[model samples]
Target: MLLIILGLALWIGAHFLKRLAPDLRARMGNSGKAVLGVMIVLGVVLMIIGYRGAEYVELWPKVQALVGINNLLMVFAFYLYAASGMKTAITRKIRHPQLTAIKTWAVAHLLVNGDLASLVLFGGLLAWAVVQVILVNRADRNWVRPAPVPMSREVMAVVGALVVTGIVMGIHNWLGVQPWG
Candidate 1:
């Protein structure tokens, strides 16, 4: 739990540093990017280790019925994430598709996982995404939406999302966690 909290702190701090202390971050220049990357990677490692090692403390029993919904949400989440990178039509509508995807992913996980560690991990991430979105919007008030792409690009984004979702499912299965329940 301590490790998880520490990891979350590092993750949030690294992410927010640029926004919170723009001058300090700018002063470091490219070196700051490297440091931030290292901090984020280390934070993720600590989170994985902490979460895996933490004793199970259930907040609520696993809801089997929600598994299907969670999976569905996950597909949408993946789609949103892919759309962000592909700059699909959806990206024109959504200013922060990636962050929205993260929030969706966090919510999907929370629906299926009802434990202390899961709460801290997913909930904290969800909060971060929401706050980050707010902060970004505040900073960049005159945001211009991306231009519309062709329908083929939209199709490609969907296909890419599905492929990524499949790969993620396979990885989950390999890790001894059944994502498709």
Candidate 2:
């Protein structure tokens, strides 16, 4: 639990360096980016180790119905994630699609996984993303909406998202939790 918390702190702290400690980050220059990268990687490694080691304390009983909903959310999450990088019609409506996707992923995971570690992981990430979004929006007050692209491009994006989702499921399978049976 300590390791998880430490990891979360390192990860979230590194992420907010620019927003929170801009001068320090500027002083560090490109080396700051390298340092931040190391922090993120170390944080992730720590999270993986700590989460696996932590005792599974269920906060609530598993809600089986939510599993299907989570799966659907994951699909949309992946779609939104992919769409964020693409110039598509969907991007026109969603200013920060990647952050939104992260929120969706956190919520979806939280709905199904009731363990303490899951809460710490997903909930912490959700909170971080929410704060980051707020900071970004506040900093960039003039939100320029994306131009709409062709419907065919949007369709292709969806197809590409689905393919990415399949790959994610495959990785989940390799991790021992087979998303698809």
Candidate 3:
């Protein structure tokens, strides 16, 4: 739990460095980009260690029964994840689908897995989503839609989600976490 919390902290803290500490970002940007590089490495390492330290959570508490609706959220998560980084009209319409997807993922997990560690992990993600949305709103960045996503990209997105979902399921033993475990 400590490791998990530390990982989340490092991950979230590193993310906040830019939003909460723009001056620091400017300084780092000015200093030949060393600070940004260090921050990225440190954040990624901490998150992996923290995630690895978390216990295998199989039987989630029964606050809400796992159901098909929850699965819908996961599918939406897939869509958001898929749309990210694509230069298409879909992104312009969705405008931060990835962030929205994170929110959905956190919420869906929270509804299904009612454990302390799950709560901490997903809850932090939920909070991060809120902050991200707020930050985006505050920053007022506009998303311009380019050409529509090629039908192929849509196909690729579905395939990517399946792969990710499958990988997560396959590694449930190592992950100590599962959507349907």
Candidate 4:
């Protein structure tokens, strides 16, 4: 649990540093970006290790029906994440597609994972995403929505999302976790 908490702290702190202390982040420049990247990666590693090793203290039994819902949400989450990068039509409509995707993904996981460790991991991420969106909106009030892209781009984004989701499911299965329940 300590490691999980530490990881979440590091992840949240590193992300907030840029928003909360813009001057400090700007002063560091590219070096700061590199450091932040490393910190984020390390935080993810710690969270994974901590989550895998932590004892499962079930808060509630997993909802069987939610499993299908979770999977569906995951596909949408992945699509949103991909759309953010591709600047798809949805990007013009959504202010923060990537962050929204994170929230969706976190919520989906939370629905299925009822254990304490899962709660800490997914819930913490969900909180982070929400706070991040708030901070970003506060920082930039005038958001210039991206121009709409061609339909082909939207199709590509959906295809990419499906491929990524399949790969993720494979990885989860490889880790001895059944992604589709």
Give the Cα lDDT of each candidate.
0.92, 0.88, 0.71, 0.94
**Candidate 4, 36: how far from true, in Å?**
0.8
Q: Quote the positional error of residue 1 for candidate 4 in Å.
A: 1.2
- Predictions: Cα RMSD each: 0.9, 1.5, 3.5, 0.7
lDDT of 1 by residue, 1-181 (tens): 8888889889999999988899999999998999999999999998889998989999999989999999889999999998998899988888999999999999999999999999999899899999999988888898798988888888988888889989999999999999978
- In model 3, how large is the Cα lDDT of residue 114? 68
| Candidate 2 lDDT tens digits, 16-106 | 9898888999999998899999999999999889988999999988888888888889999988987887777778888889999999999
- Return whichever of 2 and 3 wins on lDDT: 2
TM-score of 1: 0.97
lDDT of 4 at 59: 98
| Model 3: per-residue Cα lDDT over 45-147, one tens digit each | 7656765667766556655456455666787687678778654345767777788889988888778776677787888878988897888777777655566
In model 3, how many backbone clashes occur?
1
Q: Which parts of model 3 have CA positions greater than 4 angstroms off? A: 30-60, 63-71, 87-89, 173-178
Q: After superposing candidate 4, which stretches have Cα over 4 Å from the reference?
A: none
Ranked by TM-score, the better of candidates 1 and 3 is 1
Point out where model 2 deviates above 4 Å: none
Model 1 spans with C-alpha error above 4 angstroms: none
Q: Give lDDT: candidate 3, residue 28.
A: 68
Candidate 4's TM-score reads 0.98
